[model samples]
Target: MTDLTGLTIAEARDGLAKKEFTATELTTSYIKAIDSADELNAFITKTPEKALEMAAASDARLSKGEGGALEGIPLGIKDLYCTKGVGAYACSHILDGFKPEYESTVTQNLWDAGAVMLGKLNMDEFAMGSANETSYFGPVKNPWRAKGESVDRVPGGSSGGSAAAVAARLCAAATASDTGGSIRQPAAFTGTVGIKPTYGRCSRWGMVAFASSLDQAGPIARTVRDAAIMLKSMASVDAKDTTSVNLPVPDYEAALTGNIKGMKIGIPKEYRVDGMPEEVEANWQQGINWLKEAGAEIVEISLPMTKYALPAYYIVAPAEASSNLARYDGVKYGLRVNGDDIIDMYEKTRAAGFGSEVKRRILIGTYVLSAGYYDAYYLRAQKIRTLIKQDFDKAFETVDTILTPATPSAAFELNKVVTDPVEMYLNDIFTVTVNMAGLPGITVPAGQNDKGLPLGLQLIGKAFDEETLFRTAGVLEQAAGIMDAPAKWW
Candidate 1:
């Protein structure tokens, strides 16, 4: 049989339904792919035994014609999600060897839908950093490369493993989280599809916290339809998570009609940041042209609050991160470093456990939340976040959706941006507004740059309106027709 590993979720599901291959065969194919692709460092843990066992059951169910939506699909779980008994470190030293007794709600939902877990994928330490360099497990290398270049480039942050794995075909899809572009940025870099549903669409129970308000769970998949199918299972209202929206999850895959006729798509002028690469700008214009050809009405709109998104995000996200990460004291279940006294122990353990980037954010977070500066920094950032949301709200009043370049440039070399924290933070410039506004946004691989690296276009939709984003992204995916896989080197 042709390489089953390369087939998308929809193709795999259809193949399984037709009995062309058993679930065990599909799972084994992915295992072999994972073994061969280890150089990418995509997975931190491999659950092959568990995956095969589940696949066998799925085979039996398929024989009985009773398979679930994702029956027999093998997937990678981002290390941030707690997978009962599997090591659930958020790629941070502080949570070393920590395994939760319960599975994250999102992963549990995937399991219920018959998706088999291949293993835990690597990510940025505590979901910090923009280039995946902060990962204690080491940075994930992007599967794609610039023309004629051999030096490995970074897969985008936090969800870097998810993007790399999906791009490399190590797994059918991966569960990823977004806090300031973790999902979308990596998707853009790796030329895969990623969507961050509205803030409350997916329950956050059992997922490690990054920034309570901004962190959200989503999927990184090989195609727009795969992402829609994965997200349908991942999203649900949970009594355990108060922030989860209590609404029925729609059939997102069904929403991809590929008929976006007369759709009013807004082109945000503010996204045309100074110093933007010409290739990136050209790619954005190409996306606009593609949509216009598909009968989508292009409209220019101004999001006046765009300039404040990055600074405000830095303040609010880190401030909340500080509060969430405070639980990793030496007294907890993870690593501990001893000191002369309890206070000394807390200081020593934290100082030893967290990475430099984590330390920097924590210090900044603590400073903003400090009694004297709370109003001046954290409070003001919160107000700016409100305005950012308002800008999108007003724009949506006249447009069905908004489009922008997913990233300012293609993937950069590892440690290239890390040296300057500000430059690294700019990676999320085009994406953080979606999180701040609590709206759904998707990144579709639109075109390739002069160097042959992929560049994606972003689509922002109304709150809890992921269906529209999926539909629009599907149209762009068809119009762009740029689904070429990276040349194999690993």
Candidate 2:
């Protein structure tokens, strides 16, 4: 029998249906893989006992010839999603020992579809950093290494662990969230597929609040089809979350026709950022050529508001972060440090709980939302955000979807970029605009750099039009033919 740990979600699904492998066997294989993969620091929590229990239930259902869409599939949940009875910290000390009484709407939806939980994956502290280095649990190492280089590269952030786990085949797929480039950038770094559906596509009910307006939940998987399958189970309308769109979810897997004939793909002029690595540019051109050959008409389009996206995002995200994070004061749950007074306790708890990057963003958020600066900073940034969305609205009128480099460069060695905060933030340059516009964006591994590290191409799609992304990404995935796994060095 093939290694159960090595199967993709789609492959595992078919295998389980054929009765070639029991869910217990599959679950045990993943448990062993995760137990041995601690060096990668991808998982923050492990639920081996719970996983086996769920797997047993799935096997009974499969034996009865009845199973849900994700029956018997094991998946990693990003720490941000609150799993009832499971520690759901956002990789921050502030939420220490905090377990939700109810499961997150997204995770609950996955569970309803019969997906077994492997464990909680690590992520940025409060989902604030671009590199996984900012995670309180420590950085997640990218499974991919540069050619002959011993230095450990980061798997990208805030959803770094989700990407690393999928790339390492630790899980068939994992749930991930995108506030800025959290989902796509990490997928680009780890040679995995990640999609951030349009804002409101997935219910945000139990997802730990980051920037309320920008946070969205999605999936990271080894292949586009697997991601599509996961998304189908993960997205739903929820009465608990007013932001969740009440639209019928599509069968995203069926949409992967691997045909993009006559599809209009736009290449945004502004995405050609200055100082983009040569390898990134070449990979992008290669993607364009592949799509062109497959019959997608490449059109040049302009989104001049791209330059202001980062600045506006920094402002708006932090402002919301300031407001949403205020709930973490020592009053309710989590860590609490005793101080001389209530005010002293509040200051002490936050200071002790939040990491440096989290503190930095909170300060920025507070400053921007302060009485005197609200009009000059927060309001203006909101106005710019509207303009950024308008830019996409205009482009989509002429083009079906937009194509760009997922990141400026391939994954870099961890800690190398963290010293300069701005440099670290720059990693999201090509990705943040999609979040700002509240549009769907996906990262598909396209090619490898000269260093042998993976690089991906970004596909920006119309709102609620993920089928087009799956179709186009499937075409690119076939053209690239990159299904090799990283060498097992860990």
Candidate 3:
């Protein structure tokens, strides 16, 4: 055996069932890799003991001919999702000691499918920042290394650790959440494939709230096929989450027949932002050209409300985050920087526990939802959100999918734009719209930059149309193929 590090979860399961490798061996290898790759700081908590136990159970199930899609496959879960009896920090200091009594719906679904957890991956505290530098534990390092570049670039945010781990072969695949650009940005940065399904597709029952309206959980993996398999296990309706719709989950994997001979893909004009790198634009055009060559009709479409998406998302998401994160008071089961009075205690705890970016978001959120500003900010954002969704709804009327740049550029060096909050916010421009409209989107490694860093292209689909998204992405992915670069391509 060459080693199980690079295999996908589905491939690993098949191998495990065939007795090609034992789960114990595979999980142990990941534990070793996690330890060895300490420079990345990708994981907040690496749990080899839990992984071994889960692997043992999976092997038992396989012996009984009951192995699931992820039987014994190790996954690095993003810290935002709540895990039972284990630390589920949202990468925030305030939630330092907070352990959920129940598992998040997404986590539970993966667990029920027999996925072995490697550990909790790091993220921006409460998914607030773009760079992984905002994490309380430390910033996650991009596994890629470009020649002549001595500095380590960020792996991308919120799900940065997940992408870096998978890229570094620390785990086969990892579970990630996408509120803004979290999953896709990190995946792009680390040269992995990540999909963000339509909002409400995956149950958010126990996911530690970031931005309630936009928060969604998805899978980050090395290949689109693997992503499709994991996504299938993730999408389910849970009664516990009121936002979850009662729609039948699609057979996403089956949709990957590798045939897109008669699909209509829309190219949104609004995505051509000013000052975008020529290479990124070229990558997007190449992706479109490739898909067109695969027999898909390419149509240029206009999404007029696109510019409003970022601004609207900023208002609505932060507003909801302020409300959702308010529970982390001193009375709750988390860290508390004590003070003399109750209000003082609350203020001190929040001021001490939260990072600067988190506090900034909270302040912005509070102001948007505060007295007399609701109509101008929150209400207006809601209207724009509807318009964004409507634009997609209308576009889908003429096309099966949409094509755009996942980000304006490739991954940045650590702390390159962290000091400029506005610059960091611009990174989410291409991604936040999908969340606002509650549509499924995906990021695939399209091409590399001049310096050999991975450049990602995005595919957007209709509501509950993850099947189309995955199938289309799979077709495009087959055309794009793997990004094989030297270790120095970072």
Candidate 4:
């Protein structure tokens, strides 16, 4: 038989329906692939036994002609999402030995649609860092290496493992979350497709909290169609999460009609920052040309508030994080350290449990939310966030969607930016505006940089308008052609 591990989710679904192969056989192929790709460090835990059992059940369902949309498909769950009887550490030492009795609403929806779980993928601690280096489980290496060089690069973060596993074909696709640019940035670096839907599109009840107002869950997959398929199953309204929107989830896959005749595409002039790499600018122009050729009218627009997005995001995200993370005290279910009394215990446990990056964000968060600085920092940041949303709201009046580069540059070597936190924060320059405005955004691999590393172009849609993103991304993906899997060295 052909290599089952190489098939896309759509192809595998069709093959399973025709009885070309059993789900167990497909699951076994992925199990063997993961076993051999250990050098990438994409997974924190492996669940081969559970995966085989689930695939067996899917095979039974397929035989009875009663399978769901994603029946018999294998996937990697990010460690931030809780899985019953499975470790969900968010790749942080603080959550050591903590496993939830209930599953995250997102993962539960996937399972309900017949998707099989491969295991938990790695990520940055508390999803706090731009690169994956801050993870207590260690950094996830990018599967793609620069031309004629062997230095392992970062796959981007805090969804690095999800992007790496998908690029390496360890799983058909992986669940990933974005706060500030976690999903889209990593997907760009790894030559994959990732989407961050409108805020509250996916329930966050069981996903570990990190900057509650900004965090949104999505998927990283090899193709745009696969991403559309996964998002359909992963998105739903939940009674447990009050923030989840009650709108119906449309058939995202069907939205990819590959016809964008007379659509207006916006090019934000503010996105062309100083000192940007020539290749990134060229790729942006290339995306514009492609869209123009596909009958999209390219119009340059201004989002004046773009300059303030990053700084405002830093203030607002960390403030909310400081409040949400306070629940991880010593008296809770995670790591604990005994001390002289409750206060000492709390201090000792937090000091020992949290990593440097997490602690840094927590400190920034606490300072912004403190008594004297609340108005100067957090409140002002909220006002800036409102203005940013207004900027998008104004732009959408003339354009159906906006397009830009996914990252400032392609994947850099691990530890390259770890020393300067400001440099690290700049990685999300092109992505945070979407989060602040609560709009949907997607990144599609568009071209390769000079180093032969993959680069992606981003498309931002109106609130709850992921359908337009998929439709336009389908054209971009078709024009760019298929990105070959990185040469495997792991």
Candidate 5:
């Protein structure tokens, strides 16, 4: 029995290098685990034969003494990332049958590092929903039960499948995207560590764009070090993306130190909103105390314009998404619906392809970006976004990292939030600021709420300083320990 569940990528790589397990054995175990976890609805498409073939090649390379760090390490690439010859559908009716010839930089980078592709996981349509229930394929059920409950609950979205799959050991890790908490939210919900690297740290080329300015690729894995290893492998410079940075990539796995001596952690005073749950607040305060015990200095700070982040992001992200998604007419790519005329074709195509929430965002975005309203809305949001970034800049000058809740409330019931659009958007209250600032942010499993569902403490870092963010998160994760909330879901 290959029982390497919850093993970090670094651990797996070393074991593979030592010939403790052949790539074929590892891939076979994971394929079986994924098959067994079908009730979770975590996968949209799987490539078992392709995975085994890749594993055999990796085994040969190891035999020839030419194996790479990630040779044959199976990874679940989120459906949003384009994999060559693999379905790159975004769990939407829109991009049905969409397969891209070119590999997304993130996917290509992972392939270059020698990871075997397990399959594409499911997600919310256009990455719009807070819960995975909005995915066209179906919701990703949390692998853990809700406290003492019996019913299978949803893992968060739109990277819900990746989080659930990783938690359940379906893949060693998953490549997930975070625009407004897609990666972090699901990670928190499923008791896994997920990171959203600084904007452009991982190239966006080949990633199906949801919100161009905010969408960034990152790793979702079991442990902090595992995430670090996978993140290093997935990041690279690409000529295809205009925003790509040509900077040297860091050895993230090599940078892990379990010590946080003299590290300054800032606690934003304003994040203690009036409406916060008592248990959540206590968990956060406990996390602050844990960092203090870990030899970190806790300082009070303020991100004054934080209140505007959610509204601003809702406006800006949708505006960008609206423009980017305009290209998906039924004629060119994806699901097509015929109509009587050209205008009718466009309308019919969109109606058939886009989910209701996606359509709602498109309408909101179009309205906000309308010529008469651009200055009043879109431009103002842009200016606010700049201010949000500036707030982080000023705060980072005083502290090495900022700590906040990953989400305002723990994972809510399915569709409990979907009825009210604003309520659902508010689920991202604690996460949107990091994206707005274009800085690195990570969710560390903090503790459970009174209901005892998992909660995560978020740490924000300087631009491109995912090193610091992970280092700090690794410290917290070890101290806070694993979430025991809802065990039956597993």
Candidate 6:
């Protein structure tokens, strides 16, 4: 039989429907593929036994012609999401051996739709870093390497493992979240499609919190259609999450009609940051040409508040993160260290549990939210966030969606910028604005950089308008052609 591991979710679904292959066979293929690709370090935990069990159940459902939308499809769950009886540590040492008794709403939805679990994918600790390097599990290696270079490139993060696993065909697609560009940036680096739906599009109940206001869950897949399919199953309103929107989740896959006739696409002038690589700029222009050719009227628009987005995001996200992560003080669960007293124990546990990057953000957050600094830092950042939303709101009034580069550059070597936190944070320059504004955004693989590394173009849509993003991204994906899989060295 053809390599079952290489089939997209759509193809596998059709094949399973026709009884071309049993779900267990497909699951077995992925299990073997993942076993062979260990060098990528994408999965922090492997659940082959559980996966086969799930796939066997899916096979039963399929045989009865009662399978759900994602029946028999295998997916990699990000470690941040809780899976009952499975480790869900968010790739942080602090949450060592944390196997939640409950499942995350997102993963539960996927299973409800018949999706099979491949295992937990790695991510940055608490989803705090721009690159995967900060993960206690170690950085995820991007499958794509620069031309003639031996250095392993980062897959991008904190959704790095999700992107890499999809790119490497370890799973059909994977669940990923974005807070300041975690999903889209890594998708760009690994030549996959990732979407950060409008804030509250997916329930955040069981996903480990980083920034409550900014974190949104979505999918990273090999194709835009696969992403659309995954998002349909992953998104739902939950009473457990008060922030989840009550609007009906549309058929995102059906939105990809590949027809964008007369749609107005906005080109934000502010996204043209200084010192951007020429290839990224060229790819942006190329996307513009493609959209124009597809009958989209390209309009140059200004989001003046864009300049403040990164700084404002840093303030607001860390502030919320500081508050959210305080629950992990070693008193309840996970890693704990005994101390002279309660205060000493709290100090020692946190000091030993948190990584440097997580500590840095927590410190920044605490500093910003402190008594004197609240108004000057956190409050001001919140105001800037409002202005940034207003900027996007104003632009959306004229254009159906806005376009930008997914990242400042393609994947860089691991540890290249780990030394400079500012440089590391800059990786999210093109992505944080969407989070601040609570808008839906997607990144589609567009072209390869000079180093032969993949680059992606981003499309941002109005609040709760992921349909437009999927539609526009379909057009771009078609125009760009299929990206070639990286030459496997592992």
lDDT of 6 by residue, 1-490 (tens): 9999889999999999999999999999999999999999999999999999999999999988999999999999999999999999999888997889999999999999999999999999999887788899888899999999989989999999999999999999999999999999999999999999999999999999999999999999999999999999999999999999999999999999999999999999988989999999999999999999999999999999999999999999999999999998888889898999999999999999999999999999999999999999999999999999999889989999998999999888876845568888899999999999999999999989888999999999999989999999999999999787788998
**Which residue pairs show collisions in model 6?**
none
lDDT of each: 0.94, 0.93, 0.87, 0.95, 0.87, 0.94
Q: How well does model 6 score by local distance difference test?
A: 0.94
Best by lDDT: 4
Indicate the residue-level lDDT of 421 in model 3.
83
Writing each residue's lDDT as its tens digit, candidate 5 over 225-311 gives: 888988888888888887878788898876678889999999999798888988788889898998899999999999999999999
Candidate 2: regions farther than 4 A off? none
Q: How much does candidate 6 score in TM-score?
A: 0.99
Question: Using Cα atoms with residue i matched to residue i, what is each candidate's TM-score against the true structure?
Answer: 0.99, 0.99, 0.98, 0.99, 0.97, 0.99
In model 3, what are the clashing residue pairs, if there are any? Answer: 144-490, 145-488, 145-490, 146-490
Once fitted onto the true fold, the runs of candidate 4 whose alpha carbons sit more than 4 angstroms away are none
Query: C-alpha displacement of 426 in model 3, angstroms?
Result: 0.4
Q: Candidates sorted by lDDT, descending order?
A: 4, 6, 1, 2, 3, 5
TM-score of 3: 0.98
Instruction: Count clashing residue pairs per candidate.
Output: 0, 0, 4, 0, 4, 0
* Model 2 alpha-carbon miss at residue 10, Å: 0.8
User: Candidate 3 residues 86-121, lDDT tens each?
Assistant: 898889888888878989898889999889999999
Candidate 3 has an lDDT of 0.87
Q: Lowest summed lDDT over 10 consecutive residues: which window, candidate 2?
A: 414-423
